[model samples]
Target: MRFDIITLFPEMFAPFLASGVTRRAYASDQVAVRLWNPRDYAQGNYRRVDDRPFGGGPGMVMLVEPLQACLDAIRADRAEDPATQVPLVLFSPIGKTLDHPAVEQWAQSPGAVLLCGRYEGIDQRFIDTHVDAQISLGDFVLSGGEIAALALLDAVTRLQPGVLNDAGSHQLDSFNPSLDGLLDCPHYTRPEVWQGQEVPPVLMSGHHAQIERWRRDQSLQITARHRPELLAKARAAGRLDRKDEAVLAKIADGL
Candidate 1:
């Protein structure tokens, strides 16, 4: 899959694309990434891309003209049929919050054009005309959409085959369906005893069933304590079986 990122600070992505475990995905072209700077397409002595908002805002708004020109160049380079043109995604406060499912979907897609807005925001006209989708990290705001874009790319890239050393690692990640959308259990490594605490006996028992049961119990407890809403969702979806309910019941009873 290919992602064309339109940003004013393309340099910010250079190190990110080259570093991390997900770099394997980029290096092997499994998740092809191309950065485009809208400033390059801006028409001015200073090549400005932002301007004062018409309604008199505190911050400047990204110009639609430069962004449109950049998108045009990208479309020509992609050379895809108009009917099959990839979605243009903008990171914004009003968009759907990104999550595991969204990342999974993007991982399997043909990829998209990611528009990273700067200053106050992009011109509303440009967003309405060109953007096909919008995604938000959360309720909070950022200086620019660059960080959000990086987050999305990293999440999607890591899900590509061979990106992680362990093929099944992500399957056990928090919010994955394999774990029934539960946060992962605590993990201990190396020393059986750390400081004064010893690794749980089940973990060292060489009994897979007992170990898995212990992990399930821990996962249920942690989720109930930290994110009870997820447990509620899992229960609503009928993903919590008898054994799972038993664990949750014990947690509720303070056992």
Candidate 2:
């Protein structure tokens, strides 16, 4: 898969591509990432890409012409590949909040054109005409969409085969269907005792069934305490079985 990102600060992505476990995906071209600077397409002595808003806004609005030109160049570059039907995604607060499912979809996709907006925002006209979808990290705002773009890239890249040291690691990740959309249970490392606290006895028992049961119960308790809505959603989707319900009921009774 290929990801073409349009950003004013392409330099910001340098360390990202070169560092981390996910770098394997980028290094092997399993998930090719190309950075495009909109300023390169801007027409001016200074190559400006933003201007004062028409309605007299507090911050400048990104210009459409430079963005359009950049997209045109990108499209022409990808025109050789008939199978490259990429979505133009813009990161914005108004867009759907990105989630595990969305990450999974991108992991399986051919690629996309990620537009990282600056200033107040991208021109609405450009968005209406060119953008295919919009995604948000959360309710909060950022100085630019570069961080969100990086988040998407990191999430998707980690899911690529061979990117992670363990092939099935992501399957056990929090919010995965394998865990019925529950947050993962607490993890323990080599030391059985830490800070004078012994490792949970079940983890040391070496009984596979008992270990699995303990993990599941911990996951259920953690999720119910921190994100009850997710547990409710799992129940609504029929993911929680009788045994799971019984455990949760015991937790509710403070057992």
Candidate 3:
């Protein structure tokens, strides 16, 4: 999949694409990323890309012309017709909050054009004309959309086949379907004894069924304590079975 990012600070992504396990995805073009600087398409001695808002605003709005030109160049470069189905995505607070499901959708898609707004924001006219969808990280704000874009990239990249060393690792990730939409259980590594703590006996027992039961119980306990709402949703979806409810009841009773 190809992700074309429109940003004023293209340099910010250089290290990110090369520094992590996800780099394998980028390097192999499993998740090909290309950065475009709107300033490069701006027409001026200084190649400016932002301007003061029409009414009154503290920060400058990104210029429409430069962004339009940049987007045009990208479409032409990709030989994409004007009516092509590629989605132009803008990151903003007004959009849907990004999540695992969205990442999964994008993981299977051909690619998208990601607009990284800066300063106060992008020109509304440009967004209205070119953007097809918008996404937000959460309720908070950021200086730019680069971080949000990278988050989506990393999430999607790891879901690609062969990206992780363990093929089934992601299936056990929190919020995944395989875990019945529950948070993952705590993990313990290597030390038979650490400081005053010992690895859970069930983990050391090498009894697969018992170990699985222990982990599920731990996941239920942690999720009930930290994100009860998720547990409720899982129940509403009929994801929890009688055995799972019995485990949750045990945890609730201080077991």
Candidate 4:
């Protein structure tokens, strides 16, 4: 997969693309990333990209000309094809919140072009003409889209094939269906015994099937104690299988 990131601050992406699972993914040729600076498309001595709002607003609005030119150049390079669509996303607080499902969808796509808006925001005309979607990290706003871009890229790229060292690692993450939409059960290390507490007896047992059952039970138990809303959603979506229901039943009984 390939990701083209359009931003005013291309330098911000260097550390992100060079470390962790994303870096490994890029090194293995499982993924590709390129950054484009909108300022490069700007004309004049200052190479200015933003301008004061026409009617006068608090912060300067991003100029459409430079952004449009930059996007056009990108399309030209890719030789845009309708059948093989690539999503062009603009990060903004007004858009749909970024979540697991959205990340999953992006991981399956051929690639995406992300617009990292700065200053006040990009002109609506440029966004309307080129952007395929607008994604928000959460309800809060950020100074610029650079941080959000890095976040989204990291999140989606880690889910791509070969990105994870262990196949089952990300699968077991909270919100993943493998745990029936519950947060993962607690993890343990070689010590077996902690500061004062010993590992659960079930974990120390040599019964693989029973260990798996215990993990599932603990997942549901922890979810019920900390985030019953997650279990409720899973139930509504029919994500909880019969075995998961059994685990929940046992958890409830103990409570």
Candidate 5:
């Protein structure tokens, strides 16, 4: 997968792309990430990418001409024609909220162009003409979109098939279908006892079926306590079978 980010502060993405598992993915050629700075496209002596808004806003809005030039150059390099399917996204507070399902969908796309608006934001005309979607990380306000863009990239990159040594690792994340969209069950390491808490005996019993049952039960309990909405949504979707209902019932009983 390829990710091209358009931003004035492209340096902000350096840490995530050069460190941790995502960096390993890049090193293994499992994914590609590139940053494009709009300022590079600016013409004239100042090479300014922002200007005072016509209506006079508190912060300068990113100028559209430079952004359009940058994006056009990027598309040209990729051999993308005018008729190509578009998936360029602009990060904005007013856009649709992003979630695990959204990340999954993006991971399946051939590639993406992420526009990280700065200062007050990008020019509205640029977004109207080029953006295919506007996505928000959540219902919070931030100074700029750089952080959100990194979060999005990390979420999708980890889903690539060879990104993780254990393919099943990403598969068992909180929203995975195998876990019925419940939060993951507790995980224990080598220590039989930690601090004062003992590893659940069922995990050490070497009984796969019993361990599976215990995990399912623990998942139900965790979801019921921390995210009942997930269970409710699962029930509403009619994805909960009798066994699932039984597990949830036991969870509710204990609560």
Candidate 6:
């Protein structure tokens, strides 16, 4: 899959694309990434990409002309059929909040054009005319969409086959379907004794069934305490069996 990122600060992504385990995806072309600067397509000596808003906003708005030009260049470079052109995605607070499901969708897709807005925001006209989708990280705001774009890229890249050292690693990740959308259980490593605490005896018992049962109990307890809504969803989806309910009941009873 390929992603063309439009940003004013293309320099910011250089280090990120090269670092982290996800870099394997980029290096192997499993998740191809290209950075494009709107400024490069801006006209005149100043090469301006932003301007004062017409409605008297406090901050400048990204110009539609430069962005349109950049998008045009990307379209031509990709040479994709108009009918099959990939979606253009903009990161904004008004969009759907990004989540595990969205990342999974993008991972299997042909990829997209990611617009990283700067200053106050992008010109509304351009967004309405060209963008195919919008995604948000959360309720909060950021200086630019660069961070959000990177977050999405990383999430999608890590899910590509062979990107991680262990093939089944991501399947056990929190929010994955294999875990029934539950948060992952706590993990302890190496030390038979750490400070004053010993590893849970079940973990060292060499009994797989008992160990899995212990982990499931821990996951249910942690999710109930930290994110009860997720536990409720799991129950509503009929993902919880009799044994799972028994564990949750014990937790609720403070046992």
- Local distance difference test scores for all models: 0.93, 0.94, 0.92, 0.85, 0.86, 0.94
* Candidate 4: segments with Cα more than 4 A from true spot: 241-255
Span of ten consecutive residues with least summed lDDT in model 2: 76-85
Model 5 Cα displacement at 19 (Å)?
A: 1.5
Pitting candidate 1 against candidate 3, the one with the higher TM-score is: 1
State the local distance difference test value for candidate 6.
Answer: 0.94
> In candidate 1, which residue ranges exceed 4 Å CA deviation?
none
Judge candidate 5 against the unseen true structure and give its global Cα lDDT, from 0 to 1: 0.86
Against the correct fold, how does model 5 do in TM-score?
Answer: 0.94
Tally clashes: model 6. Answer: 0
lDDT of 6 by residue, 1-255 (tens): 999999999999999989989988898888999999999999999999999999795999999999999999999999999999999999999999998989999999999999999999999999999999999999999999999999999999999888899989999898888888899999988888989998888998999999999988888998999988999889999999999999999999994
Please give, for residues 41-115, the per-residue lDDT of candidate 3 as tens digits: 999899999999999969999999999999998998888776765799999999999987788899899999999
Clash number for every model?
A: 0, 0, 0, 0, 0, 0
Q: Which pairs of residues collide in model 2?
A: none
What TM-score do all the candidates reach, one by one?
0.98, 0.97, 0.97, 0.91, 0.94, 0.98
Report the C-alpha displacement of residue 89, candidate 3, in angstroms. Answer: 0.7
Q: Stretches of candidate 6 above 4 Å error?
A: none
Candidate 5, residues 51-147, lDDT tens digits: the string is 9988775888899999999998889777776787447998999999988889889889877898998888888888888899999988999888898
Q: What is the lDDT of candidate 3?
A: 0.92
lDDT of 1 by residue, 193-253 (tens): 8899998888889999999999988999999999899998899999999999987887899
Better of 3 and 6 by TM-score: 6
